[model samples]
Target: MNNMRISPAVISKLCCLPAFYFFMFCSLAAYGDDSALNIELKLLQVLNLDAENDQQKMLGISSIRFLPSADPSKGNLILLSDDTGAVENAYGIFETPHTFDVAIECNNHVDGEVCQYEENYTRDDLHYPPLFTEAGLNQDQIDSNNLWCSMFYVGSFFIDSSPVCESDIEGIELLSGGQERLVMEEQVVGFTFSTPAVLHLDAQNFVTHKYTFPFSIFGFKRNWSNQNTQKTGVRPNGGFEGIALLPGEEGLYAAVTEFPLMQDAHLNRFVLFSLEESGNRMEDKVMIREHYSYNVDKVLPEGAAVVKPGYPKTGVSDILAVHNKRRSFITIERTAIRYINRSISSVNKLFLINLPDSSDQFSSSELPTMSVIKKEIPIDSDVMNNYNIEGLTWGPELAGGNKTLIMVNDNDAGRASQLTKIFIFEVVNL
Candidate 1:
């Protein structure tokens, strides 16, 4: 039943290591934990993956996590991909070990056999016939027409793309030939893990279960788009941005929305969903156990000279649960801007919030927002010149009370040659 694959080296190590050593091995692999209790991250080093300046359309890796490695210097990094829309029915997958290639792979060019990189991006696949007539699309049509669900985009026939999406009689499109296709706004919403996991430089141990959330969140407030409906939810490009698995609870996860929902403009909404495996992947429903709102600090950063300054540009990027501690996490808040041709960020900061267990769903109750009261931890722009820091996670442990912390820049904006930067920090005072 556990049909996952791993390298022989890992198999050898796991086979010979004592039972407690198994836990030790797992300890070496950070479970994205840190209580965020009075901890400080000291700058150690910065590595530019695009030193050759080659990454192009494929360079935007929104989030990242490190594969387990004994040698911290040589581990392969797992970079999550372009943040948008639902993909497929994948579940009961990661257990023994799963291998995935991460980041930009340059098939187009190379130097001395080591592939140089270029990422090709396109958004022309939004038209689908199956979505129009309850026709049910083929796998290719389903995959090609990545379903978009943010408030800004809506579909003609609705289909399974959005909760607000229902059959619109007049909205169907009849092509010149006999065929018909559905018309939808080109811009898609929702976030799914995209690509690049180096199998050679990696040891595999990842998510034990696949996760799925409400399609409504993607195309929230889509009733405005629907011929006759108005269900307000997510903002444009602001669907589920982060996922943190609860420590003690099975299948329980904290799903973080990037910005405030249309109804909850004052704070960011965090919804808790419980996933249960079933015979049908499509039938794999997420139970909304509870939700909460976190009051965000929109105040701009205090620096000598800020690069990009936009009030509406601020939002939460990612969240990570502290190890061994339930309901504890550190959230990444970013205030970004466009400087010249590059998409630079003026602010990068972290706030610690310990969420409580068992809360009323945000929409159902009139509850006060939970403010992040911990002292602000700002990753100095001077020290970290490369901006747009979207992802952060605990790395391999270090000597003494100090631990290794790794943060990755999205290279979210700018041209193809934008440098992909990964920051290393010495986390002290744990």
Candidate 2:
């Protein structure tokens, strides 16, 4: 029998070899499989819809949806318009502060017509004045304040234009026509509210609908009035900033940022509603409400004053609910002041939130709290510098079972930068 003795140096090298091999194996496995860390973003297209005049700049796209077309190879983009300024009044009197829908075709071709307009729905054709008046708003006041309903944003499935659950089942007819045609359900839905005034639009038309309820709906002791003061404890200005329809569920979730004027308010609230259809209007019944207090100071830049005396630190820019999953992705856009020169800079971060499983009943008193998973996705500085990125939606499916994320910015009014940019990135793991 022969006994072999290896030197200490040789033994150590052999031991290190196994560890190195294991590390490489794990790395290779992750690269091959669907892993979050391995997720890669690919910029596919940058559709520019800007024109020579201010009226033609398609920059104020606050909400976007990648609608499935008859041809699977091609996809349609539906954008909901909103104001870029803090107040809609920034658009001069001659420039009507109206919101509309613009549908464009996005194909594999990278030609000039790759993003040509397919259809246009003007505010006149989509605005429903009665929806506000029906909510106890005085028509005279609405007109006096120049408070016209404008679509702030939109949310829906990637393939379907409507919510996962038919809003009509809740006894609300969303279409101006009849519910006999289910195809109308696929129409783009928008949300409008009293912006810069306080009242929030919870939901809007199938493509743009704003639903308002008394503060009491959320267990608050305030009535809907035009006081423009927080003494009512009622949020009059911040309404439906972001929206996401729950996948494979009968629920619709929306986010409303607390008015910057509210002294004691630091939390942004998410309201859950049951989507129902009412004639020409999508009716949303408030189910439950949950609030999240974001750490603005941690997310903001140096010398930033997120919690100002009368300004909101962060706003819910956009929200997207992943397909066939109970997860919601939210983007928060924060404004900060630079320490050295007091210059203002914008910061954007994405939050992946886990939603509760669907149940037959939801109680307002005990709403489920959404927990954030990942919050490190940063918006490109160039995009933030030139435009306010407010619109976000799930893009079409990509090769290798990956997904796409589409973001659009709202270019400020009267800017000579007639370049509306669309950022497209493929989601590898998500």
Candidate 3:
């Protein structure tokens, strides 16, 4: 049994904070100092969901993917956020600021209707650069890549508000922006096909045009009202989390953090769902569950830091590894990172489970397999106790390619969170 004890001071510390209430309304953002930290290993940016401004309180980051362009820096970084719940639902381009502008998804001030767009946006006067650069592209290419093909996908979480419910695909281009051109028309096919409510958009575009079945797949499904739902819904919950889009498929496999700070539960989960060709309702979504045990006294008598031989090992000193060599999907639970004192730190031990043939345990039809490539993370400290692990990306498979694994944490939008760190590692023979 886990001890659910908390000192009165810790309780008071949480109750007195207004940000805690704000978290109920918005997802927690990744809080870190603006001053660059010298991350000697792989680095991942934390999206502070509670951020009050683009430069501050980094709110939930909707997407993070590499833009395979000739110039890596110019248009290589693609990042977006709803921007503090302002302008109904607004999206802005990161990596470049001069050409950035906001796209409205809904007008909250409107009366009687919910989650409906009082207006829309376009690229003709796109009002922003690197904004919808692919606008006016071949419809066939858009369909093949599962790109939104429009300036933006807008609609409500409620079903009856629009003709095409759950409409969220917004296209982008160098096209300019204007109200007459945008709000004047709506995608009739979108509204006609699904409920105006419950539509969602992708956070980042995959390098390729479609989905691929790389391994045994597991997806998440939940009440549309849940936070995870909101994050992936027409609106989103925020973070630089990972989602894989495979070849020739419209479905997305998204990995989400299942635990939060101060929570006693240790079980973490991820979900998978498919979007229609029209980018509407998730067609056959599923849930993937993984339970991690951190009972230090019982499981690690020699301490979690002591590794058993024959497990994956590396000469990388200054990092922790014990039974780190294993094959399975990996998730970092911040709640599992523990602190022994200000100077000494202890982290939750990482665990693994074999993949089952059927995904029947999940709510959806897709089942993930054990055939995954496990890369030991470069968490220098025992990654057993902290609660903010929020980022994950697979390394390149071939030699001379990037075989790096990285993870970052959410600081819970507080000064205490400024200590959040990103850890990097490489995969070798296990």
Candidate 4:
């Protein structure tokens, strides 16, 4: 202490060094401990089985919606299966290097001697279920009718015989329009009938309506009536392939894909409908209407559907709408191949489309200018070839103005795998 003294500037400079070191250590700690920064994508959950033992398969998950839960940190996830049923067992249970077969038989004819024949059909061959039909039938009859109707239309088994061992009249009554009448005529002799075998005469029971079938034989006539109702709005004639919850409205938007398999050629657009909430329960209102049209072919990747010609080249596979800081909506378009195995080999595309204010109308013109977010994203992987990306929604918010996006794959196609994967991605600047 030989009268040595430091100036204020020197003292200040010396104080800054430790502060800098402290900040550096803190930053390093955050960088090391924070999981959101290191990886762009993370696997959250894998839902393989539902309550009924139906394993999630290829294109199994068509839509996803996030419902507000009591805990702000968590949300109830509602998943819509593209089609509810077992994955089409194309190959035998013991077959290796599993492959899809339109029709497979266990035994073959050897030297003109008939052997045991075990036939296996793919889901594609036995189309899932029609999106629209008369209701009121029990679940068993509904399923039988769905199978017979699919067989009648897809397999060209237009005869009156039921593919399933059930009453043909039960399935015939479920059909709509002339098909119902045509099928019923085969069962009813000496009777001339009109379309709409089951006619909705009244609208008192909005949830469930009454359908009447009029018949006459030998100057005797009577009105046969049946009750039919829809659970969630009018069952979409087209498959419910995509859904987006309205940010600040009492409704959600849904999309019906334009593939030939759905058999709904007229519905190639998005629909906006309100949801009726009763305490903890929610049901769709019967007031859904067209919202917008997003053509899939406009952004179809080249050579995408070459492997599966039957699959639609372009269709809206999934949709997610969120509001930007400007109070305008931005939609994420997830387009994918429609086939099961082919979708694995094909690449899916995602686009960002800006929407007008929620009060304003949506136009197809906005689609042409939509910006591409990620192009050429493969639905399949080296480990899993039948993974088809379908469901997408906004996940929990992340730090640094970044948002998280969650997507799920439908894995029930070529292989009978029970694993359905959920992927999380961090959305950075545009």
Top of the candidates by TM-score: 2
What are the lDDT figures for the candidates, one per model?
0.43, 0.40, 0.25, 0.31
* TM-score sort, best first: 2, 1, 4, 3
What is the per-residue lDDT of model 1 for residues 313-409, given as tens digits with 9 covering 90 to 100?
6677777666655676767777655554344445665665666544434434222544322323333334443376767766655434355666777
Q: What is the lDDT of residue 228 in candidate 3?
A: 51
The digit string of per-residue lDDT tens for model 3 on 119-223 reads 121111111112133545454543433333232232212212211112221111110111111110112122321111112222222211222111122112212
Provide the RMSD of all predictions against the true structure, rounded to 1 decimal. 15.5, 12.7, 18.3, 19.8
Residue-level error in angstroms, candidate 1, position 74? 6.0
Worst 10 residues of 1 by lDDT: 193-202
Q: How well is each residue in 203-312 modelled by candidate 2, as lDDT tens digits?
A: 33322343433333331332345464434232443444555555655445544442321322454444445434346443432334444333322443444444444332
In angstroms, give how far residue 101 of model 1 lies from its true place. Answer: 5.2
Winner of 1 and 4 under TM-score: 1
What is the per-residue lDDT of model 4 for residues 1-430, given as tens digits with 9 covering 90 to 100? Answer: 1222334355334322432122110000111122111112322223333223222232344444443234323343434332322222323221101111111111133453211211231222122233235244455654554442221111212224432211111111111211111111111111122111111111110112212121111011212222322111111222234434445553343333333211123234344543333232112122443344434434344453454554434444555564442212223333344444434443443443333334444322222232222121112122222356665766544434455566566554334344555544445532
